[model samples]
Target chain A: MEKSTNIIDCTIRDGGLVNNWDFSVEFVQDLYEGLSAAGVEYMEIGYKNSARLLNATEPNPWRFLDDHFLKEIIPEKKFTKLSALVDIGRVDPNDVLPREESVLDMIRVACYIREVDKGLELVQMFHDLGYETSLNIMALSSVPEHQLIEAFDMVKKSPVDVVYIVDSFGSLDPKDIEHQVNKFKDMLPNKQLGIHTHNNMQLAFANTLTAMRNGVTFLDSSVYGMGRAAGNCNTELLVSYIQKASYEMKPVLGVIEKHMLEMREKWEWGYIIPYMISGVLNEHPRVAMAYRASDERDNFVDFYEKVTSPESTIAPASK
Target chain B: MEKSTNIIDCTIRDGGLVNNWDFSVEFVQDLYEGLSAAGVEYMEIGYKNSARLLNATEPNPWRFLDDHFLKEIIPEKKFTKLSALVDIGRVDPNDVLPREESVLDMIRVACYIREVDKGLELVQMFHDLGYETSLNIMALSSVPEHQLIEAFDMVKKSPVDVVYIVDSFGSLDPKDIEHQVNKFKDMLPNKQLGIHTHNNMQLAFANTLTAMRNGVTFLDSSVYGMGRAAGNCNTELLVSYIQKASYEMKPVLGVIEKHMLEMREKWEWGYIIPYMISGVLNEHPRVAMAYRASDERDNFVDFYEKVTSPESTIAPASK
Candidate 1:
């Protein structure tokens, strides 16, 4: 039954948040081939957000994935299909090509509960362009039950193929994940479900697995857990743990050797104490991320005191 | 309801395995006081194994855990009770004093399937001496169903206070934990259950929580997860996550600041790739531990190749 599960490797896309989507061509190419060899269903190469709409000057091919550039990078499609993510307001409808004309197969839209209608609009556009689409409802842990119920009304009627339960703070445990999955299943009986987790409490892989066992088909993970702040679930962990004959652990290990280990050293991510505190408190990791960036990074006691102080509402800028 | 759940902090005892039980007097003293202030139910100070029986020459107070030395270290016992673990053949009957005459409230026997009868003998002796006792069945992942069923026949008839579901290799997931807890509950209806997990797949905390939710009572953890290989679940994580009025997070954090952080730098533990591979394969971490100690520690690809090779069975000495 688990053989039908879809593993979506997001090494370049989610990890790009840590490195500002500044990955080398060689790393991305190798990652694509490695994920293909590992029998991962999908590889999320990068964000497809329009740079012009976001008022960005730099031409990062990964951040604003050009179909032609992607084709040039890998002329032949491997076993793994390609996907890209976009925020609600950043992507221009004019910028997206039809799936038949582009290298990308899936377009995932990530948005907050308040932006569900807008997210649905983007999903409709992507579906109309003949691409598979999923809507990731970010910060599900923070959303109220009534708000989520209201949001699901729009989602149930939308063109989205899969609905994701995103533990944005990495705050949720397996019990919480089970509750959310049950609620999602009850609300969206006609749609497939997905799970996107962060590793703040070191529960990302566990939570993802919990969701999968409870019938979530799509799993989002990264190699070496390389993402923002506490990072996401490690892709290799999923490939190795999931009991599917098609999945191979060696290729995932090879990719980690060629790229992830060096990238981990260059950038700071994964389970540090500050991130753990933030995840426990169910707060956004921006404050902890800022704390880690300062000279007092190792001053965990100070960080805890400041975060838990009754008078403190230290809101750091989000990544 | 969760207030009835017992938190057994095993920082010194489990972490001692990593550093050969060579903890300083001040470190152990501070840990005891910290755990007491944190309102933890129990603190496992060290092993109570007889050094003479094991043929050891060095006099490590923590390793041997003499009652007088333990009393000297914690002259005035506070909120937390004391416990110590012993191997099946390592402890002499005369070495253990009655609970009323000693600092230790509990004596836990750790053993493999083949040694269950011997472990039960030790458990009976400790119980007769008026001490709380648990039989920690080590390496439950590797133990066959029939073997565990056979072991439980002896456990159900014994004087053990709790029966532990120990994931010695850090291999099990929450689903696996749920099944094991259900099986334990079904087999030993009269005995309380405990969980001892490792962080190889970063599921230690989640697995423990899963067991607790499924009615497991005693939770084994170490401050900052300082045990052998990938370590145990973090004590702070359990203290913070468990919604018990008696649990305090600040003192746990203080102990982590004063000792565990430095200890982490001196020793290597927690979720490294080699340990994850071993956990995934359901193999004991001794091979992974040996790989980590060698000059080719960073050669993850080579390690994977060697471990997965059909002709290879690299068995290293177990801890």
Candidate 2:
């Protein structure tokens, strides 16, 4: 399993949602070194979304990653390769450099089920640019069967290196993950499969292992589960459990002890009541995240009532 | 699954290991009303272990639950039944009252694999006393195959109502749990199965679901995952996910908001790094628990090195 498995650390990429890409260059540099030493396969630095489209007056190095800037931060490539995620319509084709010229070895395109065609267009461009590519279809639990069939029609023929089953809502259990993995394997027989999970039900690590056991290659995780609400799987758990002789847990622990322990205090992530409620209902965490920021965060009974009420927009979980 | 399923919330019993049985009578009363309203099947109030044998000078209401004290705290019985857990040889047989005369509906006996016979003896006595009984085999992960076979031989003849797979070290994933459930089902063909999990590696909920999927009926959990070292599976998660038409998430949430939020701040639990490391290594968390109390609690890199080093006793996980 370790031979086929690839851990893609997404601390700065997904964790940016919690703290607005506020990571220091020193911290990012230390993380890169630590992950490399820990034998992590790839590190998703951040999004490569266009700065102009977002109307950013100030520089956000991580959100709008530049090839030249990335090279400076991670001057020399080590054991771990670098990657960046890009959303459909947010990335400008002109901005992407050839793989030989840029520090990034792969570029993942993330989108909803309806945007598979748009996502593949980016995948094709990235593939042709000599970089490894993956198309991560987000909010997978909510995608209708017909939409997946339509999406798979394009996905199977796309030049993407991997197709990711992204549990954006953190709603899935191991059984659900197995069903989706088998579906992906059947639909995209020629491509490798990846897993991106959230820990709302504390199943991120379990679900990731399920995917790996089912032959998925890429596993997305974060240091101390530092991502959006409920967070991603802990990279340390994966590293320790994978049973790869080459993998080391100490380096991953090193960076966490040095930086993440303090960052956790400043920015909230990991499992919370609202996030768990959202996941149980199979809805996006936006409402829960909003509630967490407000003064009524700890009032879990009210939050449960608000979300599960008939008048509320949150649809019941499909099961 | 919910039709046959019985949720046994162990917040006071298992959680007592973390707080030294320091819970107030008012808090216990609130928990009883809340769980009853939530339609939970049973609540394991605390230990039925004897104060006479342990020489307890102070009144440890929950730890050494007197039927008189329980009657005073609960007053009137609601929808939820009451259970108490006792260790083999630790309980004073004279202290237990017959079911017709006592408030306790069940008495669960917890033991190591080697103590199966002793555990069953207690279970038999409890059963003859007109109480439902269970035998919980602790540390299922490290028990040798031969030990399990010998233990199961005795367990199969026991009069215990339920046989439990207890992950005392929290060292199991869903795959391991599925394998164990099949073993339990194969060996003890006539008995019902239960699952008691800890969150050392955050697989408590996932493993419980796995067991349930395999037809285990008894599910053990705690509020806010508040048990010893990384805690137990969350009762809230199971209540919400089970989709039992009668179960309500609000009452569970209500008690959590009213009591657990403040309790969590004072008493440590959930997925801390040391507990996780111990789980991944398939070892007891006593070392990690002691380290956490020390000044070097957050020095995870050192802890990882110390545990994995050849000189240490920490055993590698059995895959």
Candidate 3:
């Protein structure tokens, strides 16, 4: 096992998308304690985006992620470090507290290739605030190679501790992951690399293993694969498969038992056909997610026809 | 798109394990037509074993696969060829008809490593009957390399047209498939290779593609992945993903819509967690399948504990 290899549990942050960040605090607390016990290096509890900037009427604690609330919910910090994600335009710099005052040890900036500069700016601010930072470039499957190179140029000079290869659409196979990892290694030789994969094509765990084998240091997974459309790489699988001395599979399985199994019933996720088709076509899963929510959920052929028709662009539905 | 690559639809034969060969004649006929239209080279319609030899009282057309019944069901043969599987001792030599008198173009012999000689004897008989023969060695993941190499020496001299690498437990990943294909190639240089995969770890499609890319010719799949446990690689995925001019996705989807979707609800198959765990551990799914049948079906952690306990050997349940 690589000494620098770290597992980041993002169940609350990524899974919150499926249920509007409505997870109970008890579930969140249980997950934090479980992840710490499992010897996971980091736990991303939720997003730290500014609700006022997005003009949201409803106040969800996980969506906004107040430092005071986090401290109250998790009074004791265990071995696992805490992190949160922030979108380029959604988070306000003024709203973030310094690392010494807040429980969060890391702030991850997730952005499209076009927003790399803005994303790096946030990374610089978080770095100046005495926090570890990572820049997660979303939707690597759809990004043109030249644009990725251009983004890496800015990233290589930035204070971002890690640059992630994000398979936002769950579209990549191990072959593709290998190619991307090599590209990132070549472009950003000074920085460590991370991997965040989705299960659309049922390749999440395999792809993550491929990345790990190719020298990726940071791995992002969720408990019981609870995330967006097809979910993420399973944390239990990662813990059990990775031959690290510190990692334990029992704690990961414990958290999954305590929360994710119930969440699975209420939320429709994992390797459904629609998500798979979207993945094979190398498209975002938002379209497939919408189709699954519609009345014709079981009508796979209809969904296939709609996505592959000559006139159909099958764009992501508006949020 | 290798010219030698062929798709074999095994819905009826493999899926019969789940539904006790109870498929309606109409469904079988439609599947035959759909597979033909989709340009699948062969379809394994049913088993060719003699029920009397196995001491069975009740007779089912599919389980017995009478030539007269097959002729009635598929009076007009289309582009696709027909095949049937038989166990080593379960099939009586006198029960088989010559190719001139039967609708089946191929007779596949499925057996364990210890039954190689017996299986080869059946293959020789089928070859003398003027039918294409394939030796399907089941449970290859559990077979030792030395045993497989020894079996292949006898198989190399036999008249079998294709030898299959069967992932009976759905336990293999693409990397494992690649290694197995190379080993098979090294051992049996003259015989064409086939791949039969289960979806226990949701790697069926990916593993099949890996084998195909590494020069395996015959690919086995089921409509909507309707087989035992987690089922087989979906025929629809293979047809749509394999970029051949003869392959058409709509026909495969049509059959799935007409028959498989309804079959899915009544009989559970595909990526359930217990099956996935079995696949990950490289264990036969009979244990997981038994767990699914018990009242504690949804208790994944309990199932995991039972299977992985130090005292639990988890041998397949006796039929």
Candidate 4:
């Protein structure tokens, strides 16, 4: 069994995609406090992308992750640390300030398999500025073996301390996680390995445990399985399942009880028919998402035909 | 991969344990017609146990599953056959008529590992009375290896055609299921294997799939994962995930649309903190069930401590 590592919950950041960053400041504040008490290592406030590029008209807290706004939301640092995420072309380097001046402790960079070079650029900038950094390779299930091998060669020299195996499609089983963990160990043996999983095929918890047992250091999860599509692994599940005293189960449950229940009611994520079908077919969940948005999503035959139709081919990627 | 065989949906029968057999005849009839259209092989309408013994006070229509009442529920047999469950000492053999005269086709018997002989008694009677019978050995998780070995010696010679590897506590993993399947195959090579899994640990679907890939022929599920505690495997998920042409995705979806949508609103099941804690502790879900019934049930820390208390020990087995 792998020793207990830090848990970094990205419910707000990843789950925001489901509702277009519609979470209120109060919700975020409550979540942060609960996560702090729960002994969570990090609570990802939201994405640090510039709103101008995404053209979002909504209150862009998740899009910008302003330093002033974050300070106001989390007035005091408790047991939990703070982190923010950025995409390759969506972020501005100038937006991040010194670690002490800002509430953020870490800045994570998420990019496609092809964008590793560009993603390393952000990792270098963050590392230079004294912020702990990680480079997350997204959609790992679709990445070719050679591409990952080449990307790891470049990533090994970068300043990032953590490299993640993202199961964006929720299609991989425990064996897949084991293979990916082994590959990470062989390629970037010096850097810590992280795992992010979705529950489309109900493999998130198992796959996460598998990676952890195989020496992965970072585990990503959310409360009540709230994230994009089938949602990330449940934070509460991990906290209680792990045999570590430092990982507090109370704070994660507090978030679930105080916020995530209502959030689940408002948004459509987690296991639904369309998501499960997309997962089994190893396709994107777009058709399932569209069907779920409609009144007829529960009509399995109609939903199956619509998704498997000759005219429809592209599956919905994770947000 | 093993060829897919019959899928027996016991949403009402197995799920009734969650709510104590409170389903109306109309709901059962709707499920029967719906499963038939979806090409489900069997519909387990309800248990045939005597309510007097269990002291169950719920309405008796779908509770006891009367053969005369079963005829009225589905005037004509369709693509889906009918099945009912009976527990040791809970059923009277007189209630079950021959399959030719009754609407029920299969009579499944549930028993603890110690009661295999008694359970086989009912199986022999049901088989003699001309009904396809199965012996579901409940809670294989906690049963000692020697007990199972002794039980299988008698089970191999019984009149039962199907012997199920039941994960009543939902605490087993895929590896556990693989070991159990091998043990059952070695013991009862002449009989077919069935799988009845609970989702206390969120591995029910995966375990079922693992069993199928190994050699199990019968798979049990419910609509939208509605069953006792963490619930059974989702019927919709299994139908969509498997490659069985006999399973038409449409009818299952219709059942979800008409019944489960509103049903989900009324009851809470699926992956939750309390259930996950029980699975992690390798314990039964009774503590989780108790928490869910209490005001502090959603409190993860308190739930964890209660289930892991020194006095909690191994939960006594109950149907």
Top TM-score hit: 2
> Looking at candidate 1, what is the lDDT of residue B206?
93
What does chain B score (TM) in every candidate?
Answer: 0.97, 0.97, 0.97, 0.95
lDDT of 1 by residue, A124-220 (tens): 9899999999999998888999999999999989989999999999999988999999999999999999999999988999999989999999999
lDDT of 3 by residue, A13-52 (tens): 9999889988998999888888888899999999999999
Q: lDDT tens digits, residues B226-284, model 3?
A: 88889998887788777788988778877876777788879988877788888878888
Return the TM-score for each candidate structure. Answer: 0.96, 0.97, 0.94, 0.88
Which sequence of candidate numbers ranks them by TM-score, best first?
A: 2, 1, 3, 4
lDDT for each residue of candidate 1 in B110-224, tens digit (9 for 90 to 100): 9999899999999999999999999999999878899998989999999899999999999999889999999999999999999999999999999999999999989999999
- Determine which window of 10 residues in candidate 4 chain B has minimal summed lDDT: B310-319
Name the better of 3 and 4 by TM-score.
3
lDDT of 1 at B237: 91
- Superposed on the true interface residues, model 4 gives a C-alpha RMSD in angstroms of 2.5
lDDT of 1: 0.90
Off by over 4 Å in 1: A315-319, B316-319
DockQ-better candidate, 2 vs 4: 2
lDDT of 2 at B165: 96
State which candidate has the highest DockQ.
2
Question: Which digits, one per residue and each the tens of the lDDT, describe model 2 over residues B1-319?
Answer: 6688899999999999999989998889999999999989999999999998888898888999999888887889999999999988789999999999999999999999888888988999999999999999998898999999999998888889999999999999998999999999999999999999999998999999999999999999998899999999999998999978878888999999999999988989989999999998888888889889999999998888888888865444332
- The alpha-carbon lDDT assigned to residue B17 of candidate 1 equals 78
lDDT at B54, model 4 = 73
* TM-scores of chain A in all candidate models: 0.98, 0.97, 0.97, 0.95
lDDT of 2 by residue, A1-319 (tens): 6687899999999999999999999999999999999999999999999998778888999999999999888889999999999998888888999999999999999998878899999999999999999999999998888899889998888889999999999999999999999999998899999999999989999999999999999999999999999999999999988988878888998998999989999999998989999999888898888889999989898888888788865434432
CA deviation > 4 Å runs, candidate 3:
A1-4, A313-319, B313-319
Cα miss at A164, model 1 (Å)?
1.1
Best by lDDT: 2
